[model samples]
Target: MTHPQIIARCHPALEALLPKPTAARAALPDWLRAMPSEAPAETLNGDPVRTLKHCPPFLDALSLGILIPLATDLHFDKGAVSWDWDPPALPDTLISRSPIALHLPEQATGAPYPLAVNSILKFLNFWTLEAPSGTSLLFTHPLNREELPFRTLSGVVDCDLFRDGYVHFPALWLDRDFTGTLPAGTPIAQVIPLPRSAPPELTVTTMTEAQITANRALQTDLATTPGTYRKRFRH
Candidate 1:
């Protein structure tokens, strides 16, 4: 679909979260060459119909390590939100949903890129059960990457928190990219394994405000000076 189509069909929340779509469509292919282009599926009715999969053009146009601050602020477990100073806790599931991953620096200090949410929304919305199972949706950058590994998660928010222009997204679902062998037609996304990734014990202590300010600096660099940094994560 074209850029206009993406904007028109996307959730208002997504539009509000991203910067303007400034990357030219022509430059996208090379920037996202590592991401898989298709999700493998056996079509029903005994015929396979190749459906198009999507990722945020924003991500497609930039490297993964540019949007780090948002990712840094998204650490949560047991209903507590805090920053850790160890290696990040990237998500892993054994089922294959699609090929996608967020990049992180080998060390706890790093940044994130401003990727398109429409593509991200497409990847995570594969979940079948949930209040918003089939809605056109996307999460805030921090919430999507750290709080909710998969974007299609659904749950209720208290009206008071939601009414004041703030909402806490408690993730109950995620479309994890599976990297293991599996039987055919498994509907749920497979858990992606992370042997090469850092261990769970790793942590990075950070202040919320400081991380956000740092993250903004990185985003600015990504938009204006695409160079000045190298790839810090391994695929």
Candidate 2:
């Protein structure tokens, strides 16, 4: 089957500071790429599907989206936000400074807003996502990653029609006690491109007798032969 293509671009000035979109496979962390020391077992740990490197779909989604990075050093001190940078005025001199990432004065639009239902929201958009005609871009937090100090709010943009405008990201800074430099090149979002067609119909059913037998056989194979899924089932 043919694969769909997602195109990523940026302003000429940001071309160097920001990373061009790359195949998700290239972004896999070294730890995820390494195989587990123990051999396959009957449990989830032994299963290659949970073993990180052997999971294809998860890795494939990661390859989507233009990876945006911090343009400067950002620091949060207790409830106060502060940073140290050269020229000390890049936000004023630069292309676009996302107010969502900064601590603005009370009178400014950059001021933070707290929500009663969930976490607070800020106006932190930094990237513009686009897909081919008849497609859209889904922006979300990286899948299965809980180590980061912030969570990006999920969004869907009809990029094919909105290519000229930039969509900013509003993040909920999770680590209130966080302090120090959130260095540049740190991945801040994952963008997935999908077709804009309507959702397909869904069907649900119980397993048939033959399917039950097949599952039993597969279970026996999994117990007897390690990596059965890795060797045969995984695409």
- lDDT per prediction? 0.29, 0.60
Which candidate has the highest lDDT of all?
2
Writing each residue's lDDT as its tens digit, candidate 2 over 74-172 gives 666654555453322244334354334433333233645442223443434345555789988877776655766777767898989997666666666
lDDT of 1 by residue, 180-223 (tens): 23211111121111112244695878759988998898788766
For candidate 2, report its TM-score: 0.71
Q: Residue pairs in steric clash, candidate 2?
A: 24-63, 125-168, 125-169
Prediction 1 global C-alpha lDDT: 0.29
Error of 2 at 226 (Å): 2.8
Task: List candidate 1 stretches off by more than 4 Å.
Answer: 1-41, 53-74, 84-235
Deviation from native of the Cα of residue 127 in model 2, angstroms: 4.0
Model 2 regions lying over 4 Å from their true place: 30-36, 39-66, 84-95, 98-126
